[model samples]
Target chain A: MKVKTKHIMNLFYIPALLLFVAFVVYPFTQGIRISFTNWNGYSQAYKYIGLDNYIRFFKDKNVLGAFVNTIIYGFGSTIVQNILGLAYALFLNSKFTGRSVVRAVIYMPVMIASLIMGYIMYFLVQYDGGAINDLLILFGKAPVDLMSQGPRAVLIMTLINILQFVGISMVIYLAGLQNIPEMYYEAASIDGVNAWGQFKYITLPLLMPAISSAVVLNLIGGLKLFDIIMALTAGGPGYSTHSLSTMVTNMYFRGQHAGYSATIGIFTFIFIMIVSNIIVRYFDKKEVEM
Target chain B: MVQNNKRAAIWRTPLAIIIVLIHFAPIYILLGMAFKSPKDVTSRWILPGYIYKQNFDIAINKGNMLAGLYNTTIITVSCIVLIIVFGALAAYPLARNRSKFNGGIKAFVLGIMMVPPLSILVPLYTVMAGLKGTSTYWGIIVILTAFQLPMSIFLYTNFISAIPTALDEAASIDGCGPFRTFFLVILPQLKPITASVVILTGINCWNDYQFSLYMLQSPKIKTITLTISSFFSQNSNNVNAAAAAALMGILPVILLFLSLQKYFIKGMVDSAIK
Candidate 1:
């Protein structure tokens, strides 16, 4: 009986293993190989360029600028979004009336596509006729060019992203909140621990897992952000908001250096791997302690 | 003390109301712009006097919004179905069997999840083109399923492992074959996880722009994301029309999320943290 069961298991396993190898393993190896050659995306013949593309990437100022912008966007969105999300989670997790309705309202932005959000936000931030500028005029304040200038443009775009996805972080945090035993809060209350102390001791520490996950996901999402930036600014005004992916897309489309674009992609892969691995390791360690 | 408690409640209620309004400010802005006339949209904050049918008509006709909607629906539904069927089947064995290979399979799937989708875009695009899958409905659907398969399988495996093994044994003893046992017994037990998968994958597939942009180039095959980007390019000045188009695109998703907010939130929280 046991041998027959094992054979049945093998039948299932073989097909899955084959699919994984064909789809994932082969493509990954091919991607790395293609990175080292000066092959146009279509061409069959190309010369090997060992480390040449990498070296060119270092010298390229736009690539460096994209790297900086990615880091800024990543850190900016991750921190702001998670902090707001955690706060909202805590607020809704309290004993409140109509909590479900409040949650649905707040989470509305998360359902719509980021691309659509970007387009809508563009209308809301335009200089002449934007919803925001119109409101500013009503208050006797001068209209601000939210999407025209460099720093403000990046800032507004980051804010829009945060608004659109913070509900996701909140949901994760809410799950963490539910996992905490009610006894902890009761004990804190019996000890006359104020809300601040109870939250500091009970909520923050216990919520670490969700916090780490949210941070990692948001950081990666922010770094890999291309759709929104493409829709909103198209790396605009002068590539001020160019991300790694956008830069890769631009380079590949420009059609001179597919190899260099692959190099940039490889670098991005390595960077994301390092950052996410660190966060994962940190969470794994915390998981053991908690 | 009672009076003080009532006073506190009153203050907190207003504070909560204010926060909710602030949170929903963007949607309100969009709705306001969608309804306003072009001249009114550009002017001060005074309310528009009339409904703007022209913007909706223009957006629907000039932007080809309905065609975009049709394409998006087809891609989303097809991808969701493929992910549901294949992902569940692949996950069943991994969940039931405990072996070193199973461990490796889990790790491989998890590793693929970590790799940014952009890194593989060029190669995947080449492969799709080579397969003559580019610019076809099947092209985007296949890629979507392939990309989402790992994560959906992971979720299903996690949920399935928690089910008792006695059920499987009982089915086998009752003369049910493995295939029948799976479909009749195991598949029904997967409703919760399937709900999660459907909600998550459906939303992601609907919202995806990058894959659709590269894989589907024909104007006739454009998804909502590509269509919206094109609208921005072509109708930069028609703010009300663009807003109307944008509203049309997001309204269905917004309504779906609102109706299923509980399941949606639970699914997201569970899968994400796990």
Candidate 2:
């Protein structure tokens, strides 16, 4: 019976394993191999120059800019998302009339695709006839062209991303808040611990696990952000706003520099692996210390 | 104390209402503008004066929304089915066994969840092109299922562990085989996680843009996201029409989410903290 069970267990693993190997593992290994060659994405014949792509990455201005922008976007959005999400979560956790309605409205955007949100925001941020501009003009102010400048465009994209996703962290944090045993708060209050002290000492410490999850999830999502950037900026204003993910696609599909694009991808992979590990470790340590 | 509590409620209630309004401003503009006539679209009117139903017609007819909807439905449904079935099957063993092999597989799936999909896009594209899988529903469907599987497996494994091992023992004592035990006993209890998996994967597949953009570039086979994006770029200046098209594209998913709000939130929280 034991042998039969083990065999069936092995059998159950086969389908998912095959799909993962074929699509993910195989493509990743091939991506590594392709990055080393000047293959151009089409012709069979190509020459490999060891470390040439990696070496080129160090000197390429656009790549270096993209790397910086990626970090800024990653950390920038992650920080804002956590702060706002936690605030919203805390607010919603308290009793109020129409709380569910408010929660639904805020959380609705999280369901919509970021790509769609980007397009919608494009209308809002444009100089002419934008909803924002229209509201601005209603206030007797000049219409600002928010999308024309590179750095500004990047900021808008990041903000749009944060707006669309804040609800996710909010919902998660709300769940965490709900899960906390009410006894802790009651105990703290009985001891004359003020609201802020109770929050700092009991609430915050107890919520570390939720904080860790939210931080890591948002960081990874922000790091790998593509759709919103693609729809909103398309790495425009001379690639100034491009994150590494968008830059990789722009390099390959439009630029046709497949080999170099793969190099960008490989670099991004390594960067994420390193950054995510550090974040997970840092959060894990904090959780333990608490 | 009663006065203080009442005062706090007064401030907090209005504040909450304002926050919801601000957060929902974009969607409000999208819907409000979508129904406005062309001349009225750019105005500061918070609400449209009249219901302009023709915009939906333009979005549906001009944007090829029917085809987009068809393609998106097929892809989303297939991806959800595969994710649930395969993810659950794999998770059962990983959750049940205490061996190094299962341990390694669990770790591998978790690791893959962290891999940025963009890193592997080029090779994935090439492989799909070589296999003639590009532009086909199955082409994109297979890749999405693979990418989404990790989360499903992770969630399902965590959920499955909560099921007592004694259930498996009881099944074995009855004359049930391993597969039957899982199907007859274990699978039924997975309804909650199953709902979670379905809600999460459904939204993902419906909303996925990057993979569909790369894989399904053919004009005839665009998903709703790609279709709306393409439509907006082509008619960039037609704000009313673009807004209409955007609304049309997102309405189905919005409806789904609204209807399944509880399950969706449960799924998201379960997947993340696990």
- Interface RMSD (Å), every candidate: 2.3, 1.2
TM-score of chain B of each: 0.94, 0.96
Provide TM-scores for the models. 0.95, 0.98
Candidate 2 lDDT tens digits, A1-290: 49668777767878999999999999999999999988788778888978898999999999898898888888888999999999999988989888988888888888898899988888788787777888888899989988889888888888888988888899989999999999998888889998899889987888888888888888898888898888888888898999999988998988888889999999999999999999889989998887
Measured by TM-score, the strongest candidate is: 2
Measured against the true two-chain complex, the DockQ scores of the candidates, in the order shown, are 0.57, 0.78
Docking class of 2: medium
Give per-residue CA lDDT, model 2, range B129-213, as digits (tens): 9999999999999999999999999988999899999989899999888799889989999988899899887888999999999
Considering the two chains of model 1, state its CAPRI-style docking category. Answer: medium
For model 2 chain A, the run of ten residues with the poorest summed lDDT: A1-10
lDDT (CA) per prediction: 0.81, 0.88
lDDT of 1 by residue, B17-101 (tens): 8878877777777787778877763553444667878888988889999999999999999989888887788788788877787
Clashing pairs in 2: none
Candidate 1 matches the true fold with a TM-score of 0.95
Candidate 2: regions farther than 4 A off: B1-3, B41-45
Which residue pairs in candidate 1 collide?
none
